[model samples]
Target: MATYDWLFSTLGLEQWCGASGGSAPTSLSDLAAQSRGETGEQAVDIWELPFPSMDALNDACPAFPQSRELTLGLEEGFLDIKDTLSVVLDPITQPLSWALDAALYGILNTPWWIVIPLLLAITWAVSRSWGLLAFVAACILGLAFIDHYDYAMQTLAIIFVCAFICVLFGVPIGIGMSRSDTMQNATIPILDMLQTLPPFVYLIPLIFLFSVTEPKLYGIAIILYAIVPVIRLTNLGIRMVDKNVIEAADAFGMTDRQKLFGVQIPLALPNIMAGVNQTIMMSLAMVVIASLVSAPGLGVLVLRGIRNLELGVGLVAGLGIVLLAVILDRVTKASLARINATHKA
Candidate 1:
């Protein structure tokens, strides 16, 4: 007999399972019914605890009962507000949907020959490193050879769009934070919460806020999850600007705006670039988890592998992500090095 069976019977709750007939529960169904209080039977003493517990007055209360009611309540509450939220956010997010779709479609449909050369040219222009260019070219060609070119491109498109949006807004917010200690104090806590929260946690509210079919659903999640680094680093970069340099600019009769653009930003470029690098890396890490909400990329195949227990598929997809990550990391770091070199020169 299950340990809880006696507790139920003693409380006169056995009737809940139709066991008031005085026959012991004969099957799991009886136990289930008894547990659910669904057998049209009433407990003789409904106030009695079903499980053992110390007197609440004499000892610390035991762990709270695990219940699904809270989850149900949240779902209901979200549903109640979902429509209002959708109406307000849809207009703002619709453009993001268009941008993401266009990028993905263009990248996926473009020929390899054209895409490869263009990417190599960009890499060379940024880093001017033939070795880095060759490495990127090989990575792209390898992905294509393995039939993951489309998936790789899809992942790249999402990253490109999301990262651009992150930098677009994040830098300004960082600048604002640097200018106001009150703003920094107020915003740091929020950034801490966002950064420390599990990547999967980002999807929970987003899933309820928007439909899975919408690109902004995952796009928003990616941005929120990956944006913290850039913001924090940007603020740090600006704040770290040498005071002497600012004074020199001031001596030269530069205005606040001029000093910021000419002195602070130029000096802070390296840190800002580092922040961008970290943001890109974080975005890539989230791509797989974001797939749960219908974001596509190499992550889809990874999910497929896990669902179907396909070792080769998961491994190959994982390798593809690693290659993509390495390529991005190398190129960004190379560009950062180039920027540092230019500053030194």
Candidate 2:
């Protein structure tokens, strides 16, 4: 009775025993042993765990903590390029690093009141059209008006660096893709992986490979997240070149390489530019999440707002990002148009 009470109460098995006022064997092992000796209708199963034999007992738990160092050994030695390239990039990338830091410093040092009017003037000058200029002005002032300028600039800095690098690398790769089928085939899958992976997931591997303070930390993540569209558009634009144009170049006795350089790439410039515009936009989008990893600028404000539940702070910083994205998109699209018009003329 004592065993029955403990077993029933402890395992909550009394519910299964129900009607007969809860009289049953106290243990699964006792039932199992009795089941073997019982014959015909007297048999029963007290356990849900299917066991063909005693093998099931030890097989239930998982084995782990298997240290590879003790069990087998390191799989081959480390490759030299991985470590060598890190050292080389650390020194050679100084100029780019300083430019970004300078941009951030420039914004941080300026007073909010001074920065607002300066921003409005710059927007008006670059945009030229009154409405475009006002829209740009309002966006900048709205961020500052709501007290978000500083954080916004940090986001701007990251995007500025990353997008510039994307164009720097993406345009050339796109041009190359336009010229070669093998390269496009090899490159597209990698781009697809980059595009498809969740943004948060990119930081995990990056954390191991580089410190949070490193410039390339955010630079590489932004590049990886943003490179796809530009490269694809570059490839598409080049491939979309009219066959007649190619034939005309050939008829002019232009070599294959010459034809590609002179004609196909120029024709595809719009698509390549469109890709760049998208890359810049994506780099801006990443700033907020990148803030968690010590990325500076507007996202830091956004992070602060969220961390403290400061609604005003988060909303304003977010608005600043919108302003920056619009300005960048407009500037890039305008440049693409000017380039295309020149090419056509």
Highest lDDT, which number?
1
What lDDT does each candidate get? Answer: 0.84, 0.71
Q: How accurate is candidate 1 locally (lDDT)?
A: 0.84
Instruction: Go through the candidates in order and give the clash count of each.
Output: 0, 5
Could you give candidate 2's per-residue lDDT for residues 142-209 as a string of tens digits? Answer: 66666566677667767877788788888889888877889988998999999999998898756655
Query: Considering only N, C-alpha and C atoms within 3 Å, which residue pairs clash in candidate 1?
Result: none
Query: Mind giving the per-residue lDDT tens digits that candidate 1 earns over 163-258?
Result: 999999899999999999999999999999999999888888888888899999999999998899899999999998888877888899999899
Best by TM-score: 1
Q: What is the Cα root-mean-square deviation between model 2 and the actual structure?
A: 10.7
Question: Which window of 10 residues has the lowest lDDT sum in candidate 1?
Answer: 55-64
Stretches of candidate 1 exceeding 4 Å from the true structure:
1-73
Model 1 TM-score is 0.80
Q: How many residue pairs clash in model 1?
A: 0
